[model samples]
Target: MNDARDVTILGEPERSDRPARPGREGKGEIHLVHMYPREMSIYGDLGNTRCLAARIRRHGYAPVVHQHHPGDELPEQVHLLVGGGGQDSGQVTVEEDLARVGDRLRSLADDGVAMLMICGMYQLLGQTFTTVGGRQLPGLGLFDVTTLGGEERMIGPIVLSTDFGDVVGYENHSGATTRGAGQAPFGTVRHGRGNDGSDGTEGAITGHAIGSYLHGPILPANPAVADALIGWAAEASTGREFEPEPLDDEVARQARTRQIARLLG
Candidate 1:
């Protein structure tokens, strides 16, 4: 990530013009649990996990990714867990069996492992996400979101801004996430609300978990998003004030602008 090296007047001072790297080599390992990545890995949701693991590896950190298929035991020491999007029909097929893992998942959630769930996974985190087919499948309810499915699926680019920065990704989902009496929306919609039909309350976040309907497989261009998740894992591991190197760069900035334009169009 270094562009160049320069000499300073004060007896050769060192400046970190290169990108910040987390100490991941043999330092410790952060584990990622992939849930039904095959059955429901729709749109770019799978990219979320990939970007997450990559970002961690880019930094000085070591990441261990574990795929959780049917009949596999979930790790008790997972630093992060990622669940990707899927189609509603696909969701229905696995909803019951997946729900069986709810109690164990809730236990993991309670353990303070950071999680990122997109699209169908986002809908499944709620109490129930009703599909256009008039089916209301139960969710893990790890978050306080509820979805009402519709025909007009939200599929396209989108723009979102958070403490991290302006992020560009795609929106593709049929269910609308409605925060209940005391629930908070994940982030304000700058443009292209994720749930196309409704007023675009894509998903919710409870504690260290984030569920969003936006995904262009949403990453690569936005390293800050990846760093944000990595930061969460770092916070859990180091047990101290966690700070990461700035994620903004010229290449990243231009890419972000182009992505937002596609969303605006």
Candidate 2:
């Protein structure tokens, strides 16, 4: 998967034998797990969850939001997972909890669960995150990447080019990440520092799991990614294509357009 040019937009179809939970007279509901809402949402990234739920609801299928916190039991059936950035201290707070759920997360990933992880959470999805003081923290190792803390933080509006389209967001991070062998970036940087500020890359995307530093909460400004994730989740749930009804995204489009123009300026 080192070359992202050939990486499929949606990952493999679900082959899990697990039966779907019944929703309103046998309709299958999409199970969305929001990780660390209490601790990892300092950036108001919970908006991403809300945006996803709204999109799913527009499809006429219920999308249940499960907020998973430290020490809380994880849901056995998860279609998608969304997590966000936090302070270094907050990262430490969720460390043990993440370790406890590592096996389950990896299992879900293998079963084609789509995930959107940002900044602090993105670092935790990798092998390790080293602090500026040289303290090392363990990660889930789902993505073959490592983040090293730095004094010079990359903070600004960012524009990234992907095969899907140009994604815009605001990034603020000091832990520059480096992809390990066999890893592919989600996109190339067009207007801001990415990954390590030298590679021109912004995020990592592998088999339905996405790790990025972009967090203008992400979804409000980039609905395409959100829809892709939901589409993948719907497909993974029923072994069929999930065609969502079109919803007006004028506000989101306006926000994105303004951000892009400003970034260009």
Candidate 3:
């Protein structure tokens, strides 16, 4: 679907209704699984999936978008996974289901599946998330990090220096996440509060799996990051080098440039 509002809490899986635009065909199918779209996608995060699907089409791949919710079985062949942020109550609601599939998720990470977990999902993919009320939520331990809810909310546009160049997004979270020693970070904070207010690190990266707090819906403005994930998924799925055909990203570039200027200057 083009809009996140189109996502509904249904018993079965829902595929994207967006028709495939004309592009080179026969590249292959990329299975994208979106986790907890209804309960955990409050922050316009579903846009990430839409962006990926659109980009996949541009690169000559047919995107098979799958919406995975609580109590639902995961797609057997997942090439890429994307999840969004949610509130504490929403986290609590999906905690059990996440735990049930935690092993599978972890295994996917270990198997080099390309995945992105943002905000609340990012926290839950870590070692633990202790709420301000002292309720500790167990995580999948995919990232060697721990999160604790805090009183102050860190909300702003954030810029990060990464291998993908300067990635830009918005951060709206109060969870202070501390990465374990020796754990690699996704990027370094250039403008906003990162994992914790004090840490220079932004997000955690393990293999091809990434967990971050940035949510400008993230992907639309950062084509490099999106392409990186797509490349990884494509390579892992086909066991071949995946070089994506370039597309016109002038609008995204202009948006990113302006946002960076406004936030940095």
- Each model's lDDT comes to 0.70, 0.83, 0.87
lDDT of 2 by residue, 178-219 (tens): 998789998999899999999889889889999999988898
Question: What lDDT, from 0 to 1, does candidate 2 have?
Answer: 0.83
The order by descending TM-score is 3, 2, 1
Candidate 1 residue-wise lDDT, 14-35, digit = tens = 3333433433344456677878
Task: Give the TM-score comparing model 1 with the true structure, all chains together.
Answer: 0.83
**Which parts of model 1 are misplaced by more than 4 Å?**
1-24, 196-200, 238-249, 261-265
Query: Candidate 3 at residue 7, lDDT?
Result: 24
Query: Which residue pairs in model 3 clash with each other?
Result: none
In angstroms, the error of model 2 at 55 is: 0.6
* Model 2 TM-score on a 0 to 1 scale: 0.88
Q: Candidate 2 — which residues are off by over 4 angstroms?
A: 1-27
User: Number of backbone collisions per candidate, in order?
Assistant: 5, 0, 0
- Candidate number with greatest TM-score: 3
RMSD (Cα, Å) for all candidates, in order, is: 8.6, 9.5, 3.6
TM-score of each: 0.83, 0.88, 0.92
lDDT-wise, the better of 2 and 3 is 3
